[model samples]
Target: MYPISTPSHAKLLRPSALPLHDRGGGARTVALVSPALGATTFISGITEFDPGTEIPFHSHNCEESVVLFEGDAVMDIDGREYALQPLDTTFIPANVVHRFRNVSHSKPMKILWTYASPQATRTLRDNGEIRAVALEHGKQ
Candidate 1:
């Protein structure tokens, strides 16, 4: 079973502390926190998109929510496009095809995302690739 409690003392994770994955063309992702890191039942991460870079269309088996942290983005959900700004929150229902990209050529966009499950499963809509869905503590 996954641990139910956080550390006795506060746990602080800096940007450099997390593993950074390059998504090509300067786009990067960092798994900020997760049940693997003592979180109860959710996984959170930060994704940074360089100007003109975009995440391919994808969907999660579990619900996901994202908070715009900095810069602007054009979010394409299903078939609609929406503009996002700092502090804007977007909630994506499970299995909804969507994608987002930084619209500014001079600035990058950063988003903080949290998933309903500790191990969120993502399926790339175009290629059918799945990611980040490993079971934790043998929990389904």
Candidate 2:
């Protein structure tokens, strides 16, 4: 038997309609599907990286998957670098150190990402600072 609200209606979300958040180091994020949007199992979003910019090395509490949406990128996983093209996808396990860098000097790069857990947390490798993935877009 299903609960009264067990079957929720599907939602149509447009990236252009969502809010863009600064993630420092020339990176910005746009949260798409999440608990705030009634998602119960996982969370998804898109991240845009400015030209010649990269995010700091960090790991998540759960597995993560990312697909390159535009431009070229270099994904560093566990200290090894892998070149990525548009539509290239990667599945990263939990607690693995990784980061992404835009290889182009003029064009920006974008990636669509999803976390295995709804309540995911990230820990920076440099200072061990922890933060909730859901709240990432809420901060300046």
Candidate 3:
């Protein structure tokens, strides 16, 4: 077999192919870009959020680290609120409760989330989270 650059292969994908979700609450995410590696690994693409939109308070069964690329945010984790801006990196311990909110109106929030363990994603995708019926609102 011939070899091709990873970037070349990845570029063949159209954004429309990504599975989007807004089933839970505020903000939206495209799952295909993140392409889960397993129950415990992945490099996620962009996660977009609207101004003043919050991810809602929730806890993860595993650890998560995110890098902000665009706009800014305030992360509330374990009772402390930390400001996050473009290029900022944050970490959330396993089973810890946390949330992200878009604090800018003129700019949109984008983040690169890496999961040490995608416990939630597995549940969501395996249990009809990506099913047609679960898709609400247009494309996240």
Candidate 4:
């Protein structure tokens, strides 16, 4: 176990410092920053999508919460689309198929993602059709 720290001992990190996985077409992700810094119970990171880029439909076993920090986001949850703007937060239950896309033509969309598990697992949908966006480094 790692030693618990006081609030003053909290660590600050930039998204670039974390392990970034390319999802192709300018979509990228960071992972495990929480546990890497001794956090327990949950893990968190960031995902950035460039204009005209998106993540393929997938489902995770763990619940997810995301906060849009920049630009515009169009989230397709269970086949329904929701438009998200800055500071908007969304919660997704486990085992739900969802995807995210950047709606802006010239701006990038960035979101902070948090998962209940340290290593969130996602199953990508493969239905004999080519995927527009690949998985992030072939991972969840």
lDDT of 4 at 113: 85
Q: Give the lDDT ranking, best first.
A: 2, 1, 4, 3
What is the per-residue lDDT of model 1 for residues 1-140, given as tens digits with 9 covering 90 to 100? Answer: 22233457445677666557775666777776666566777777788899888878999888889999999898998688999989999999999999888999999899988888876887988889887643311223
lDDT of 4 by residue, 1-140 (tens): 22344598776665555567876678877653455566666777788888878877887778989899999899998668999989999899977889888989999999988878766666777553432111343333
Best by TM-score: 2
TM, every model: 0.82, 0.90, 0.64, 0.77
Q: By summed lDDT, which 10 consecutive residues of candidate 2 come out lowest? A: 1-10
User: Over all chains combined, what TM-score does candidate 3 have?
Assistant: 0.64
- What lDDT tens digits, residue by residue, belong to model 2 across residues 20-107? 8998888899888888667878899899999999888999999999999998899998768999989999999999999999999999
How many clashing pairs in candidate 4? 0
Candidate 4 clashes between residue pairs 3 or more apart in a chain or in different chains: none
Locate the minimum summed-lDDT window of 10 residues in model 1.
Answer: 131-140
Top-lDDT structure, candidate number? 2
User: 96, model 2: CA deviation in Å?
Assistant: 0.7
Candidate 4, overall lDDT? 0.73
Task: In angstroms, give how far residue 127 of model 3 lies from its true place.
Answer: 19
**Model 3, span 1-140: residue lDDT tens:** 11122654542334356556663545676553222222225434457887777765665555678888888789987778999878999887765667788988777788877666333332231232322211222322
Better of 2 and 4 by TM-score: 2
Model 4 worst lDDT run, 10 consecutive residues: 130-139
Cα RMSD, each candidate: 5.0, 4.7, 6.8, 5.2
- Considering summed lDDT, which 10 consecutive residues are worst modelled in model 3? 131-140
